[model samples]
Target: MCDAAETRPGIDPDRLSFTIALQTAADQIVNASNITGSDRGIAKAVLADPLPARRPRISARKVKCPMSRYGTTPHETRPLTSRSLTHLDITVLAAAEQPAVLPPSPANTDRRSRVFRLLAAADPGQDWTARQIADALEIGHLRSLSAQMGQWITQKFLVREGRGRYRLHPQWAKTPGDSLDSTTTIPA
Candidate 1:
C-alpha cells in the first residue's frame, strides 16, 4: 500500500489520510512506556524534517496617479479648467424681472416650441403620445403640459392623430421661419 507513493512523482508529504495514519501509529509506540526519551526524540526529528525542495520568490512594481484632492468642493479647492464646466446650477437663480414675451402669433410659444421639436424629429405623419412628450421634455405637471400642448393644438401647428396622440402639421414642418419661442428669433 505504501509503495504506491513511490510511483507518484509529485506525492504530497502532508496528505491527510497518510499523515493521520502515520501519526496514529507513531503516537502509540513513540510515546510508549517502553520507549526511551532519546528514541522518542529521534522519531520526532524524522517526522518534523521539511520535505520541500525550495521556497518561492516575490516581485513588485510601482504605480503613479495625479496628486489631487478628492471629495473637496472643486469651486472651493481646484481651479475650473475643463470644457465640462458649462453646467450651471439654475435651480437657485431668481425669476426673470420682466414678463416673458409671447411669440408674435398665437401659433408660437414654449408648448408649441417643445411640440414642434418633438414632432419635427418624428416620422412625417407619425403620431406621438403626450406621455412621450412629457418624458422627452422632462415635464412634471399635467396642467402645464396640457396648457403648453393645447397652445400648439389650438394654433394648428400640431394636430391630434387620435387616442391622445399628435403629429406636426405638415405645413408647419415645411415652413422655414415658423419659430415657436417668444421674443426669440433666428438671425438668418
Candidate 2:
C-alpha cells in the first residue's frame, strides 16, 4: 500500500488529517512501549499541532499610508509636524554640543577678499583665465577660484570673456574721475 503521508505537488490535503494520523501512531507506540515523563510529553506535544509549521495561522496586521486621490500626485508629501521638528532640533543640538576637533575659522575669508581685490585691479581691456589668475595671486586651488569667478560673473562684478576667461566689468573697474563724462551737477 502507498504511504498515507505522501503528498502531491500544488495540492494541499487537510492538515488535521495528518495530525490525527500522527497522534494515533504515537498513541499506539506509547501503549506498546515503556515511554513516560519528558519523552511521553514531547511525543504528545509533537502530535498536538501547536503552531503547525506548514501553514502558520498568523492574522497579519495591515497598515495604511496616507495617499491623495485628486490626481495632483499619487502620494502627497507630508511636512514634519511641530513635535517632529522639535525632536529633529533636539537631535541636531545634541550633535552640535559634542566637542569637534575642527572649529570654524576665518582662514578662507582673507584669501577670498584678496582674490576679489586682484580681480578688481585687473585691467578692463584684459581677460585672465583661472590658471593665469591663480598663478598671479599665488592661490593654489584653481578649480574653486574658477567657481568663485563664475559667481562674480553672475553678480555682474565681472564679465565672461568666453572660453573660460573672465574680466572685471569695465564700469566696475573705472574710478569716479576716470568717467568719460566728468561734467556732473551735485544735488544740494
Best candidate, TM-score:
2
Query: Per-residue lDDT for 144-173 in model 1, tens only?
Result: 776766676777767878868778777766
Q: What TM-score goes with each of the models?
A: 0.34, 0.36
- Candidate 2: count the clashes: 0
Question: Model 1, which residues run further than 4 Å from truth?
Answer: 1-109, 174-188
Please report how far candidate 1 places residue 136 from its true position, in Å.
0.9
Error of 2 at 5 (Å): 24
Q: lDDT of candidate 1? A: 0.55
Give the range of the ten consecutive residues with the poorest summed lDDT in model 1. 56-65
* Candidate 2, run of 10 with poorest lDDT: 1-10
State, as a TM-score between 0 and 1, how close model 1 is to the true structure. Answer: 0.34
Model 2 spans > 4 angstroms off = 1-109, 176-188
Error at 163, model 1, angstroms: 2.4
Model 2 over residues 1-188: C-alpha lDDT tens digits? Answer: 01221222222233335455566667768686544433443334433453333653233212244452212232435322322223433344444575658866643345545555566565657788889889988888888988888877777767897988887776567564553222322111
